[model samples]
Target: KPNEIVVVPGKVLGIGKLDHPVTVIALDFSSSALRKIKEAGGQVMSFNKALETFKDFKGKSVRLMKQ
Candidate 1:
């Protein structure tokens, strides 16, 4: 699911088109962020790869975590 690619780095460029949305988990935060993640049709997951991170997205769709 390339379209379901999750770009761990927060470096997004407008150089191409991705029919599939990518979830960008960043180490930084920005204002008016809902527009960025929501507009991309992707979610902004924070530290989900960590042990206690699952608690953040418990009610949402999450699976297949890799270390």
Candidate 2:
């Protein structure tokens, strides 16, 4: 979705393409990946930033990956 937030528990690499614009929170990301994401009009940030931004996770459109 356009404004949804997705949390990834690992690093994001530049091996694929993103077709939609969404917010991605990950531990780390490669330079290429960052460029691609930004090119697609998506937002990227670290987990720490996410936590700081959204202290209350409830009632928000956030997606968490299963372990």
Candidate 3:
């Protein structure tokens, strides 16, 4: 979904492309990944900040991607 938030426990790489804009929260991100995400009009943030911002994300769906 466009408004959906994707959280990654590890680092996000730039091997692939994002089709739509979304929010991404991860422990860390590669420099190229950050640039790609921004180019795709997505927002990226740290996991700690995500937790602080989305306190009510308990029922939301989260898919973990393995690198």
Report the lDDT of model 1 for residue 14.
39
Backbone clashes for every candidate come to 0, 0, 0
Residue-pair clashes, model 3: 0
- Tens digits of per-residue lDDT for model 1, 1-67: 4324343445333343434455555544454454555666766655555335544554544334232
Q: Write the per-residue lDDT of candidate 3 for residues 1-67, one digit (tens) a residue.
A: 7657887878888888787777888888899999988888889989888878888788776656565
What is the Cα-based TM-score of model 1?
0.38
lDDT of each: 0.48, 0.85, 0.82
What's the best-to-worst order under lDDT? 2, 3, 1
**Local error of candidate 1 at 1, Å?**
9.7
Candidate 1 ranges with C-alpha deviation above 4 Å: 1-20, 49-67
Root-mean-square deviation of candidate 2? 1.8
**Lowest-sum lDDT 10-residue window in model 3:** 58-67
Output the TM-score of candidate 3: 0.81
Residue 16 error, candidate 3, Å: 0.8
Measured with C-alpha atoms, the lDDT of residue 36 in candidate 3 is 86
